[model samples]
Target: MFNTPGNSKGDFLEQTKAAREERALEKRRDAAAALIQANVRGWLGRLKFSQTILNDIDEIIPDVLDDTDKLHYKPATEIYHQALKFLFVWKKERDKERFAKLCRYLVASLDSDCPNIVMLVYL
Candidate 1:
């Protein structure tokens, strides 16, 4: 009987095991990369959404704070929601001082039971 070159059973088994391990390691790396990508995308999406909200708040703050009625009786509920959104965005941005100052301004602006005061405390 003659043995074929490099065809020993032990060598073949070792090659098969190595191939399987390599494939498994590659799969694990791919999965980890994908998970990291997903987390980054989610974080970016949330940041963008918060930025949009913050911009909207900025545009309307002067008018609301000045009570110029530019929005002309723009329901208290809507104003309340805007205030809440502003606080959330500020909190996320770690600007607690600004938020606190804004709250004080809002309270001060309520010189005479401004409907905004009720709106602020409503919830």
Candidate 2:
């Protein structure tokens, strides 16, 4: 019978855990960047977003995700609402036509997807 050293086993486990966590974090970062890019690009092309504000939002998003407090359920909800308000106002003031259409579509879509709407509304 052979026995492995406890310290070595613990070290291996720690390294594995760290690697998994790093990979998960990278995946999250990539997803966040992609989402922000798509939203910003779409709104910009439609003239619904300002380049400067979009840049600011893009900068803040990663920091928001990185901060543990912002990543929590309640804080995240607050952040989401704040972001939504900012974007809504930005769009409405910049592009009234698109803003009205989007708001109408959103309301109708929300009515159709009640559960998601409820979650978002509560958030």
Candidate 3:
């Protein structure tokens, strides 16, 4: 709160700055996901899920799955889905000694078994 301007317009500027920061954070997260997904997609083939599905995947899946039977049609659960337990595993390979070594030593040979289930080795 230090050095904040003491005026009504200052409040508006502060709000705008906060909004811009939020947007930048969103962009960074999206970019990070895109890089991971791109590397994954190239390795796994075209992502089985649609952008529409991926776009709202986080928010909509919860409501869509509130009724268990409704999820039957979803590709991740219903089709050639042995590899994808869920979408991505953020456990991070580097966090686990075995995985970290594998990621470092054998990552070149390690391609995704399922395009959808990405174990992010690092962000």
lDDT of 1 by residue, 1-123 (tens): 346645687789899999999999999999999999999999999999888887776655443445533323434566568878877766735666446645654554445445643434633
**Candidate 2 residue lDDT tens string, 1-62:** 24558778998999999999999999999999999999999878755545654554444343
Per-residue lDDT tens digits of candidate 3, residues 5-83? Answer: 5666788989999999999999999999999999997866544443333434333233322233332222333322322
Q: Model 3 compared with the native: what TM-score? A: 0.31
Roughly what TM-score does model 2 have, to 2 decimal places?
0.37
lDDT of each: 0.66, 0.53, 0.45
Q: Clashing pairs in model 2? A: none
The TM-score obtained by model 1 is 0.65
- Between candidates 2 and 3, name the one with more favorable lDDT: 2
Model 1 has an lDDT value of 0.66
Best by TM-score: 1
**What is the lDDT, from 0 to 100, of the residue 40 in candidate 1?**
100
